[model samples]
Target: MRAHHDRAARALGVICEGGTEFWGWAGRTLGRAGTATDGRRVWLRMLTAREAKATGKLWDGNQTAEKAFGTLGGRRPELLAVHDAAETGVVYRAELSTRLDMPVVSPDPVLRSPLSLSPGWWGSLRTALSTVAGATTDRVAVRSAYVERALPEFVGAPAPETIEWVTVHGDLHWANLTQPRLRVLDWEGWGQGPRGYDQATLLAYSLLQPDTASCIRECFPELGTAATWAGEAVIVAELLQSVARGDNEELAPPLKAWAKQLRERARK
Candidate 1:
């Protein structure tokens, strides 16, 4: 135990003890040297082998997520009160100065079609189907005519053939996005492949309002046209990714709405 203590202290470069040992830090972070009354205002986390292994891929996603939040801040600067961010493990510690108090910027000045009822939303449904298409035997439960038509649209459009790849935030939802402040943080699973994947993931998770959804699309007019299809494709890949991880309909409202969207799209 003494050897463990010595090694830990050496790794941290400080003599830490008591419950601090269970804090599970991998390295020592230099903090402001101040009087005993002030204590260390900043913390340094020791990176573990596991964190190191996941850092590269997770960081890439984190950067993209950061960009998305930055975009939100750009559109509605007041929505996001960004406090600070610094490299720590695979994710960045982005601090928010304030919380969002208004409805999401869905169908706002940025997106054109509104994410709720827009064709882009269907993409999320299709993505969900793709996620479970490989697992459960209930193929009919996940089938859709919209995907049948939409899938063919991308057949030769410089996109992958299998609809198996795309950039997406594996987990997107309201909790990840602060309201009124509209700050977005947390970048755990992010990558590229289909389009609108992130938007769909977030929508599905948050159960956005229809009017708000429209605003979301309107806010991102670039996604209103053919570009929206690419976004949809990405959503499909991400949906399947989530299903494979064994996520179920704990958030039944969003899951139901997602299903309803596919059915509505199929009718069209």
Candidate 2:
């Protein structure tokens, strides 16, 4: 793993400059993320590919963000450069952005902290959500077919109702969000999806911490509304699949309990 990290660092250095400095790194299921800097101006994220197959276009969330920044503009990283290797199926994407103090919370579900987000922060989040929700996009991040197949595995069957779809961050979680200043990161999966999908995903991830989950629910009342229930159902099914795949084992117990609770509530 150290060797891979070193190689990624070198690759990012070559892309940025000869004097790029390594900031930090963490191993992920799909790939590894390393923060690098060229000293004075920008911070570069070197994303080394692992499990992601070379199928679609080279750009993902970064591209979506780049397009949205022009009009939607708030606190999002900008795409700097992309190094694609079709033959090796490895892609190195570099993004430039201002450095953040710390993440709002750890990406790992095992970590817990007392809820500390202020009302202003919650309001800012709502504004960001509105910005993304109002934006236009042709990309389909989560396919309806996959949702249809996964929903029945946990929820038995879907109820007959009209679902309102909108542009969503698609992969909104703790790690992708920064605190104090409130900047949202990781745009690789931003696209059109069922309304409230981002909020449901965040709520799903916060299940391990009851206080935090409740806080999120309090802030985003849509989580309790019937209109967004379909979106929440998708999140539950997605999390359940993650548990079955042996991913996020730390979150499995709470996630399963929450799934059961959601199921019971849906039937009522």
Candidate 3:
């Protein structure tokens, strides 16, 4: 870790504070700078391959939040600064200074909301989906197939129109958010798709009790109310999508419950 930190410092050239234990950068723009402490510096993330993998997972989970930020930046250009993104990392860094020492390391509000399934959020999701669909050259069908094949039980039942097309933060959860203004971040897997896609994912991640989920849904009537079956389908699809690539331990339990919910609902 020390070597990694040192390498990062040398590469970026800043006073690696916290004795290289913490990830940050320190350097000088002008000579004899005190009281000022060169508050004009940024830190490099010094993560090992394992940590890097974890970061990837985090990014994957927060892909929606990141995409949302990008969407917002495009529409409201004044809201954020466009930082140069590395070839292998998420694009667009938030101007943390505006948030007053709020580093981009916390969860976002969209992630924390009760999963009432907001129709209001539909506007953002719709825009996001259109953006992705528009960007691709010709493989919209192929990717849509990936989604259906990946989670047929869930996505298959909800046909094109029935499901409603809107830009969704495909991966909406607690960790994907930032505090204060609830800025969403991460954009690796963002694209256009279903309207309830964000809602279902948000509910699954709300960590609220069943009743709470119901209340939250009511709070956002515009998102439209859903049958238990709909929620089940979402779980099944999300689980299948997460595991089809490979069975991830983290998503297993919830996905299992989702399957059971679908089965139980079908029986009724």
Candidate 4:
């Protein structure tokens, strides 16, 4: 992945500098910060053969996102350049994007504790998410069949009779959020989903921190409310499924608790 990133930088005519290398989970993605030949700071990210699937729109989310939305008021990274190549049977994709100088809210996707954030940060985040939800896109981030099956098994039966679909940042977790000034990272999964999908996801990841979770509710009041129950159930089931897979082990208890509440609500 590093070799691919380096190759892409060379091809893109960016001068690689500094040792700030970051890798995605299981080293699926690798990126380095550098400046363009014209001295513009940028980030070059490369997908490894394992994580590189060139078939689906979801696979090329970052590039597609640029077409779908132009920065979303600077909350998302701007896609600048792309380099695609194949070595053997696998394809490697590298993208150059406008660099975000802020650090992420958390290294892990799930927040284990509370962190005080300014009102300005919350306001910015709220605006960005709202803008995404209002976007028009043909991309599908969540499917009906999976929601129908998973909801009954992981959450409960009696799915909502109606659903409002909207554009969402499919993977809106703590690690994907930046602080001080808001910036959402990893745009490879933005698409249409149940209306509150992103908010529900961010809430699920912040379950351990009740204060932060409450703050989130205040910021996005429609997220887990009765009107958005279907979206909430979808994301709850998704995360709980991840919990069952031994991925979010710590989130298991809270997710199950939330599921119990959802089951009761569904029954009602």
The segments of candidate 1 whose C-alpha lies over 4 angstroms from its true place after superposition are 1-55, 59-172, 188-193, 208-211, 222-224, 244-246, 250-268
The TM-scores, one per candidate, come to 0.39, 0.77, 0.48, 0.95
RMSD value for candidate 2: 4.5
Candidate scoring better on TM-score of 1 and 4: 4
Error of 2 at 223 (Å): 1.2
Displacement of the residue 97 alpha carbon in candidate 3, Å: 9.5
In model 4, where is the ten-residue run with the lowest total lDDT? 50-59
Residue 248 in model 4: lDDT:
84
The prediction achieving the highest lDDT against the true structure is 4
Off by over 4 Å in 2: 1-40, 48-58, 70-73, 81-89, 107-111, 159-161, 264-268
For model 1, how big is the CA root-mean-square deviation? 13.3
TM-score-wise, the better of 1 and 3 is 3
The positional error of residue 146 in candidate 4, measured at the CA in angstroms, is 0.7
On residues 1-268, what C-alpha lDDT tens digit does candidate 3 reach at each position? 4443343344433444453233221420101111112454443332223323433432332333333344454421121222222324423221211112233322332233333334544344445433543442211111455444544454444323234444444555544443333334434345555545555665565433465455445543433334334433654576566666775445556566665655554455
Candidate 3 Cα lDDT to native: 0.40
Tens-place lDDT digits, model 2, residues 141-259: 66788767877786555643567888888888887777776788777677878888899898888776788888888888888677677778788788778778987667777767766
The whole-model C-alpha lDDT of candidate 1 against the native structure comes to 0.38
How well is each residue in 179-226 modelled by candidate 4, as lDDT tens digits? Answer: 878899888888889888888899999988999999989998886567
Superposition error at 110 for model 1 (Å): 22
lDDT of 1 by residue, 1-268 (tens): 2233334334434433334332222342211111111232222222223344534544343344444444432322221212222234432222221222344434221233333344544443344424422232211211234345544342222333344334344445554443443344334454443445555555444333557655545544544344445454434433444554665334444544444444344344
